[model samples]
Target: MDYLMCHIEKEFFGTTFEGIPIYQYTLVNKNGAMVKIITYGAIVRELWVPGRSGTLFDVVLGFDSLQEYEEKNASYFFGAIVGRYANRIAGGSFKIDGVTYQLALNDGDRPNALHGGVKGFYTRVFKAIPMKTPKGPSLVLKYLSHDGEEGYPGNLDVTVIYTLTNENELKIEYRATTDKPTVVNLTHHSYFNLSGDGTILDHEIMINADHYTPVDENLIPTGEISSVEGTPYDLRSFKRLEDAIEPLKDTPTRGFDINYVLNGKDGELKLAAVLKSKKTSVRMEVYTTEPGLQFYTGNFLDVKGKGGKYYSPYSGLCLEAQHFPDSPNHSNFPSTILRPGEEYRQITVYKFSMEG
Candidate 1:
């Protein structure tokens, strides 16, 4: 077989606390966009996209060292792949097949099970495989979650493939299967600052959704699919993030952290949102198969990131595409249940372009 050549460079990253060796795979597309993925947390350490002037900018927030990511990623999530359940679950508990399961109450005093519990997929090291493809270079990460690992039933096998396409798209494909009945909602958590520096408040954004799931004080969905019309949750038109986040400055969230019900057929990939940075003339278009898009301003980001830069609140923004929060508890929301013999699959693409 003739070996196909692709722009994928693998290098040693660092060791985990348990002395586990970690590796980073750098995938470069034909157009020069780059994405670096590490085995630890199956995280995207950095993503470089080109601006209008052809200057490549690292748009995602990350750490300089493995120790920093290990110590601080829990607070901000960074570029990790979060799962089991992407968002909050009410009271840290849910019922599956008439059996109640209690997950770790890791969401501080709010007492909700956030992101699969204390040891979510973001904390686990995955086995990586790099492959050259016609479309681009791909890095496949595989992880096995044992039954009852995070108070969840069934042993879930997960595979996440990150492909850097020639179209300047960072495509993430998620697939999972379980031996028993389980609920799964996997999503990427990457804090993006399209300008590559400073806050994301000035970025213009638009979401292709006419409805949103309103959250309560704890940030859990209120079980009602409310219309985005005449509401602050509306992002149907492009507007500066500063204008959208300013109204909630005194509220409990302090910024946008609600989930917008994506306007499309669930399970079908469609345009979810678009974020633009006027400073760099870079635009990011998000397309996903998930039914909801969580637009979270970095409301609680007060940590220092790579290059010794201090990131204050609203330093970046996250467009997390996944199922609605507390979907297992919300009967009306799209189902996230995955039973034996059923394969859970989702695809999300972040395509970048220069709009001068």
Candidate 2:
């Protein structure tokens, strides 16, 4: 909690509707690594690291102004924490022990509730506090989702910790407790362009999953776990996103927006994916304790981002770590229900480096 020793700084970010103040906090490690987070939605505004040539540059895509983030178009989740249910829920309804709870259908014509029924955690303000660990400088953000906040059950208290380690790892830890039975899945939404401001099509990517959940036309899982072999979904080995996306660009959805069943024990933090931008010589290794990772290419990403840069489709990508989408609707998938006493926890790490 010692700010001086941790080298954490705080400043004014902006104000919300009622003119309440919002703040931004910057964490710096001894190795010149930096991470910027804001109280609004506990969003990660910028993540900077050194490239192969030892020059620091921002790797995560976002906006310079909070207004741009607040009005981030229809597809702009932008480096914030998404929750309640991090992905899609079919028909916006789920039953728990014979009681059916209906949610809002927010995914356009899909007739599904997407990312916590619209006003998800990404749309709310979080109480942010700074603290440091032996591993690095950290920021802890807390939020209390009142009972029936988004047609979901129970009053949920959630905390998310973002740590910038000296080893160039951005570690995210999530914890939530509910008073009644409820479904909760949380993850970070960051459009990562390792080259910083260019199309991410050329990034070399590899995922450790051999199976994936196939979605219907509406992008809802058909409750089938299919093999990725011989398919463009097969990212078992390193493949250029340009090549992987080429075959699927014609699809109605336009690019890769699939969810991979992470290969490992449910709660063990294991390697999920590795991304390298040869253009910038910047590499990122993704590790997580969650069972599923949603790999979303910026297929519909048309919006103004930092420095007035216009981001287009395939400009950036997201590797969201959490439970599978619509877990409440599928009995076979890993359960996402959190009862009175059971707690929910997930950890994900994004380690950055250069070709060394």
Candidate 3:
């Protein structure tokens, strides 16, 4: 496959505690799909794709300035890597191999630990190596996690490759190895708004999931593998996000923020979910080799982002593929433990297409 690379001068919130320069790089594909990524947490600054009318728009919600990201305390993550453990860990604690571990709590008012605590991967600067691969120009990010950092055992070396394939697929390949047993679950947290503006409530979404894990008021799973047969959680078929979100306005978070068990026999690469914006005619199909997919509707984005834009609730949505939340605490959930000599690998593809 043929590819081209370019860099655009852009400043973002500095990565240092004292505030420094934040540089970003923009990579564009032959089809004109562009992805702007920064070294800070390897966050994706912008993702521009062709619309139905041959125009381009930044479909992903992000800040245009670093100060906005720092001031608003944005929870969008905005194309950042979430790790050590993704999603919520109930009670901010879990047990593995008869050993209990306590994690740092950072879920606002909730007691559970979320997205790897206050200073997760999203706040760190990763070492980026731009490579010219046979497939295309890719950016490989490497980060080392010390033992007991964020209360996770074992020293882990993680490598995440972000590749823009010629087929219009933004492929994320995650690989990690640990010297000791550790709970590892990682996924990209990008709030996608294919229409580029307005709320994503009208976006249509479909997940190839027959069962979903029910959650309590705190947003932690109830450990029950309930079928999406008759509830509003049902998305086994195509449905508008607004259709399901409007009725769920009373729930905590007031929008879709639940994890669905991707239905397809064991955990394999299957169609996880498909989202389409009728306004832009841009559609995204997600495929992943993970056990579950967390569909978050950007419910907590009530702060100002880049360019002084205040992102309201449901401004964007995310479909994160990973192990179930609190899997380390629930014995019935799929295993998230990575032992020595075992390779932890996960592949997620976001294929983009448009209709006239």
Best-performing candidate as measured by lDDT: 1
lDDT winner, 1 or 3: 1
By TM-score, the better pick of 2 and 3 is 2
Clashes of each: 0, 0, 3
User: What is the lDDT for 59 in model 3?
Assistant: 82
Ranking by lDDT: 1, 2, 3
**Tens digits of lDDT, candidate 2, 72-113:** 633678898998899899999999878999998989778999
Query: lDDT of candidate 3 vs native?
Result: 0.83
The stretch of ten residues in a row with the least summed lDDT in candidate 3 is 3-12
Q: C-alpha displacement of 236 in model 1, angstroms?
A: 0.2
What lDDT would each prediction earn against the true structure? 0.92, 0.89, 0.83
Least well predicted 10-residue stretch by lDDT in candidate 2: 1-10
Q: Residues 71-132, candidate 3, lDDT per residue (tens digit)? A: 54336677788988889998989877889899988887888999987778887677777765
Greater-TM-score candidate between 1 and 2: 1
Candidate 3: residue 275 Cα off by (Å)? 0.7
Q: How do these models rank on TM-score, best leading?
A: 1, 2, 3
My TM-score estimates for the predictions, one after another, are 0.98, 0.97, 0.94
